[model samples]
Target: MPRQACKKGSHACDGVVRRNAEPIAYAHGFDWRPAYNCKQWFAEHSEQMTSDRGGMMKRYARPLRLLAITALSVFLGETLVMLLLPFLEPLPQHVKVLLDASLVTALVLPMLYYFLFRPMALYIGERDRTQKSLSKLSSAVEQTADAVVITGMDGVIEYVNPAFESYTGYTQVEALGQTPRILKSGKHNSQFYEALWKTILAGGVFRGELINKKKNGELFHAEHTITPLKDDSGSITHFVSVWKDITERRRAEEALQTFSQRVMDAQEAERRHIARELHDEMGQALTALSISLQTAEETAESPAAAEQLHQCLGFVERLLQQVRSLSLDLRPSMLDDLGLASALRWYVDSQGQRAGFIPQMELDSLKTRLPPELETAFFRIAQEAVTNVVRHAHARQVRVQLHRREQEMEMVISDDGCGFDAQGLQTRNARETSAGLLGMRERVLLLGGQIAIDSAPGRGTEIRVRVPVE
Candidate 1:
C-alpha cells in the first residue's frame, strides 16, 4: 500500500487511517474506504449537521436553565418538609421519610414535563406525520399508471416505481445502478439528447415525446417529463423522469389521418367526374338548344312568334351560362390544362366582377406544375374562402398571394371585410361554419399542410396556408 507521511491529528489526515491508491479510514479500528467522493462530502455535511444541532441546543438554553430550577425545587421541597416535620412529630419515622420523598417528587414533576416530556411528545407527533406523508407519496408513485424514474446527479438510476418495471420490462434488480441510456431506442439523434441534458442540467424542466426500448426489444412512444430535484442549498441532486406511454394513441392518430386522406381523394375524384359530365353532356345540349331557338326565331312566319322565340333563345343562353359557371365552380378544366395559377386568375377575376370587390392577385409563375390533387385542393379551399367573403364578409377589397418556395407552397388571402368571430366559428361543434371551414381543414390536412385563419369581430380576416411540395 502507498502511504503519505502525515500526523494523525492534522487536517490533511485527521480521519484517514491509511493513504493507499484508495484512501482508507478506520471504523472502531477496522479499515474502510468511503464510496467515491462520499468521504469528503459526508465530512462537510456531518459538520454542518452537528453545527445545526449545536445551534438548536443554544436556542433552547431555557430548558437547561429549567433543569437547575428542577434540582432547586427538590431542595426547596426537602427544606419545607423539614420545617413541617416538627408539626407532624407524632408521625412514624418511616412515614415521615415517605412524606418527604412524595413532596420532592411532586415539586419536580411539572419542571420535568416542561423541560423534557413535552418536547419529546411534540417530536414524536411530528415524526409520525412525516412518516405518513412519505408513505402516501411512495404508494402513489408505486400505484400510478405513468412510469417514474429517479436518477442520481451522475445519471445512474437510483429508483424506479412499479409502473417503470411494467412499462420497460426491466426488473428493479436489472435496472438499478444502470444509466438511462439502457432505454435508448436510437430513434433520436445526438442533438436531441444534448438539448435534453442542457435543459435539465440548467435546472429547467424538460417535457417532450420520446421513443424508448423495453428489455424485450419493443419500442414504445412516451410523453416524458424530466424535473431536477434540489437540496436545501439549491444545488441539483437528482433528476426525476416521468413517462407516460402514448404508442397506441399515436398509432390511432396515424390511422385516422390515413383514412381522412383517402376520403378526401375519393371526394375529389367524385367532384371531377361530376364536373366533366356537366361540362361535356349538359353544356353541349344547352348550346344546341340555344342555336335551335335562334334558328327558329330567324325563320319564323309571324313577327310575334319570332319575338317569342327570341325571348326563349335569350332564356336558354342565360341557362347555358349558369350551367357552365356551375361546372367551373365544381372543378375547372383550366386547372388541369394551364395549372393552378391560370385557374385562380380566372376565378378571382370573375368573382371580383360579380361580387363588386377589387381583387388583388400576386401569383407565382410555377414553371413546373404541382400535383393534380394539390392543385385541386388549394383551388377548392380558395373557392370556399372567397365564397364566404362574398356571402358574409361584404368586403370592398380582397388580396390573394401565392408563392412557390424551395420546399413548400405558401398562400395568403385577406379581405378588408366585416369579420366574424374566427375563433368561435372554428370551435363551435354545431353546423354554424363547420361545413366550409371543416372542408378546408380536411383538404389541407390531406395534403400534409397547415392553415391559419386570423380574424376577430369587426376586424378584417386573413387566411394563410402552407403545404409541402415534396
Candidate 2:
C-alpha cells in the first residue's frame, strides 16, 4: 500500500496507522485505544495472551487423551473376559455373569469421571464464577448515582437503572417500553436529537448538557453522554446513555455570576462618586488656597515672610496636582465628556509617563459614541490589561490596538515582557485565585463577549477581546 499523509483526523492516516501497528487479538472485535499507556499495556499483555492460548489448547487435548485411554482400558477388559471364559466354564452361569458385571463397573467408573464428570464439574464452576461477576456488575449499575439508560439500535428503551427512574420520576414499568423522548422537555429542537443520534450511530460518543423534563413536568439540567455498543461482528447493537444531574450546580453558577456583576456595578458607581468629589470639591478648594498663598507671597513686607509664603504656595500646588491625578485614576471625566478613543489615548500616555515604558497605540476614531455601558466595559478591560502589564510584566514597551466594525469591536493588548503560563491558569481554582483575571472574564461574559489570553513562559503575553455592538 502507498504511504498516506500523516495528518491527524484523516481517514487515510488512521488506516495507515492501524495497518502499521501490531495486531491485537480481540475476542469480540473491539479495537479500543486507551488515552494513556497504550503501547506499554499492549506489550505487556501480548505475552499473556499467547500463554493463555497455549493453556486453552492443552486443556482441550487433555480431555481427548483421557477418552482415548478409557477406550483402551475397555478393550483390554473385554479381551481379558474372553480369555478367562474357558477357565470359568465349570463356574455357575449366574456367578460368571456377576463377576463380569463387577469387572465392567470397576472399569467404567474411572472412565466416566475422566471423560464426562470432570468436564461437567469444570463447566459448572466456570458458570458460577461468570454469574457472580454479572451479579456484581448489576449491583453496581443499580447503586450508581448517575442515571444509566440502555436503548436498542431502534431507539427503544431496553433497560434503565434505578437512578434513571429516580431522576426522571418514572417507574421501571413506565420507562421500559417508552423511548427516551418521554422525558423530553421540548426545550431542544429536533436537530439537536438528530445530531446526537448521528454521532452515536456513527460510533462516536456524544457528550453535552441537556434540559430534560421529569414525570411531573419539571425541567432540570443534566450532563449527558451517549455511547454506542457494538457486537462481536463489529456492528452497533445498542446505545448506552448516562445522565448526571447538574441543575443545582448550574443554578449556583448563575447566582454567583449575577452577584459578581452587581458587585462590579456598585464598585463602579462608588468610584464615579469619589472621582467627582475629588475633582469638583477638593480640586477647587486647593486651587483657591494656592492662589491666596501666591498673592500673600507677592505682597509680603519681609523677605523671610515672602520666602515662607512662596514655599507654602509651592506645597499647595503640588497637593492640587496629586488630587487631580487621584481623581483621574479613579474615573476620568474625559471618558464622559470626550469619547473612548480620546480617553484611551490620554490614559495610555499618562501610564507610559508614570511607568517609564514606551506606549504604542492604534485606536480607531469611532465618530459615533457607543452605549455608555459598553464603553465603560471596554475601557475597564483595557485598563485592567494595561495595569497588569505594568505590574507584572517588566517590559520596555506595550502596544494597544482597537478596531471598530459595523457589527462588532475588538481590542488587543500585548506586552514584550516575561510571560507566565496562560494555559495553566485556565483551571477554576487558578481563576478564582487571580481576581484580576476572573473579573476580566466575568465582565466579558456579562457583555456576551469573548476574551482570549495568549502567553507562554519567556515569551510575551497578548490579551484579545471581542464584543458585538449589535
Candidate 3:
C-alpha cells in the first residue's frame, strides 16, 4: 500500500493523521480502503507519531454523524447491536467475530458513554419534555374562554391570556409588567380593591362583579375571581385571576326590567281608558233612560209600566256604582295624582272594611313621593301582599307601616290571622297561590330592593320590604 494517503501534506494526502482511525472508519458506515492507514504503517510504526484526538472527536462528532447518516441512507444506519436485533444468545461465528473486532467491544469508549454521556442525554430529554409541556400550557391559556391574568405578589402583571386582550382591548405586550390600575373604571372604591387584595393575599379566593375600562375608555362589567397560587412549600408566589365579561348579562337584565314595567303600565293605561269610556258612554245612556222613565211614569197609561221603570232606575244606579268601583280597582287615579301614601292609606282602609277592623297604621315621616317607577313597584308589591293577607291570613287584626330612614324606605305588613308555613310557599308553584307573591318579588328585585315574608303555622304572617331611596 502507498503511504501518500497517511502522509503529511503531499499531493495525494490532505493532512497527516497521527491518530487511531477505527472510530472514524466505523462512522463513515463503510470501509474507505485508505492506503498505509490504520493497521499498515500506523500500526507498524515504532516511533511516537500519534497525538490526542478526544477534543477533535467531540468537536467533529455532529458532522461525522450527519455524514454517517447520509452514507448509510439505504438501511437504518444503526450500530451492529441494532442489526443483530433478537439474535443475542448465540450469535453466528462471523457476526460474533465482527462484533468482537469493533471499537465498541475492543476500546474503552462504551464504558465512557455510560460514565459520561448518559447523564447529558437524559438531561436533554427532560429539558425537551419540559419545553413541550410549557408550550402546551401557554396555548391552553391563550385559547381558553375566560380571560386569564397572572400577576406577581406585588401585583405586577406577569402574564395574560388572549381572551383578556380581547376583553380589555389591550394586547399582551401592553399589559405586561403594568399594574392593573390601567384597567380601573373607578366604579369601585379603594376599599373594594383593598378587600380584594386582602382576601387573595391571605390565600383566599376573591370573587365579585366589577366595572372595568377598556382601552377605548368605554366601561363594561366583569365578573371575576382571583386565587392565590402557592409554591411547593406553601408560600404564595402569584395570583391567578379569571374574568368573564358580564356587560351583556347586565344589559339583558335591564331590558327585561324595562319590558316588565312597560307591560304593567300599558295594562293600567288600557284599563283607565276603558273605565272612562264605560263611565261616560254607559252613564249618559242610563241617565237619559232614567229621565225618560220619570216623564213616562208621570204620563203612564198604567201603574205597571211606572213600577217597572222605577225598578229599572234603581238597577241603573247600582250598575253605575259597580262600574266606578271596577274602574278604581283596575288603576286608582289617586295613585297617579296623590302619590304612594294616599294610595296606600286608601288600600289599607278598603281592606280594613272587609276584614272587619282597621289595621294598626303608622305612616309618620314617610316620603310622600318617589320616582314614578319606584312608586309603582312599591304600590304593586304592597297591593299583592295586602291581598295575600286578606285572602289567606284569616286573622281579625293587621298592621301596616311605611316610613323613610336614612338612605332607605321600608314597609311592613303583619297580620294576626291564621298563618301558614312561608317556607312551603317557596316549594309551591306560583300559580297555586291566588295572590301574586312571585310577581311582587320580581318587582322588588328589579328596583334593587329586598322582600321577605315570614310566617309559620298558627303564627301570623309578616311581609317586610326595604328599598334604597334616592
Best by lDDT: 1
lDDT (CA) for every model shown? Answer: 0.85, 0.82, 0.74
TM-score, candidate 1, is: 0.78
Worst 10 residues of 1 by lDDT: 26-35
Per-residue lDDT for 338 in model 3?
89
The backbone clash count of each candidate, in order, is 0, 0, 1
lDDT of 2 by residue, 235-332 (tens): 67788999899999999988887887789889989999999999999999999999899889989999999999999998999999999999998899
TM-score, per-candidate, Cα-based: 0.78, 0.73, 0.62
In model 1, the runs with Cα more than 4 Å from the true position are 1-104, 201-204, 232-235, 430-433
Name the lDDT value of residue 389 in candidate 3: 74
lDDT of 1 by residue, 1-470 (tens): 43344454554554444454345532210011133343555665786798689889998796678778887998899899989999998999999999999998888888688776887799899999999999999999999999999987667889999899999999999989887888888898867876787788789999999999999899999999999998766777888999899999999988998998888788877878998888899989989999899889999999999999999998988898898898888888899999999999999999999999999999999888899888988898899999999999999999999998989999999999998888888677766665888888878887789999999878889999999987
lDDT assessment of candidate 3: 0.74
Superposed model 2: Cα runs more than 4 Å off: 1-115, 189-195, 302-304, 337-342, 362-371, 403-410, 424-432, 448-450, 466-470
Off by over 4 Å in 3: 1-140, 201-203, 230-236, 278-318, 366-368, 417-435, 455-458
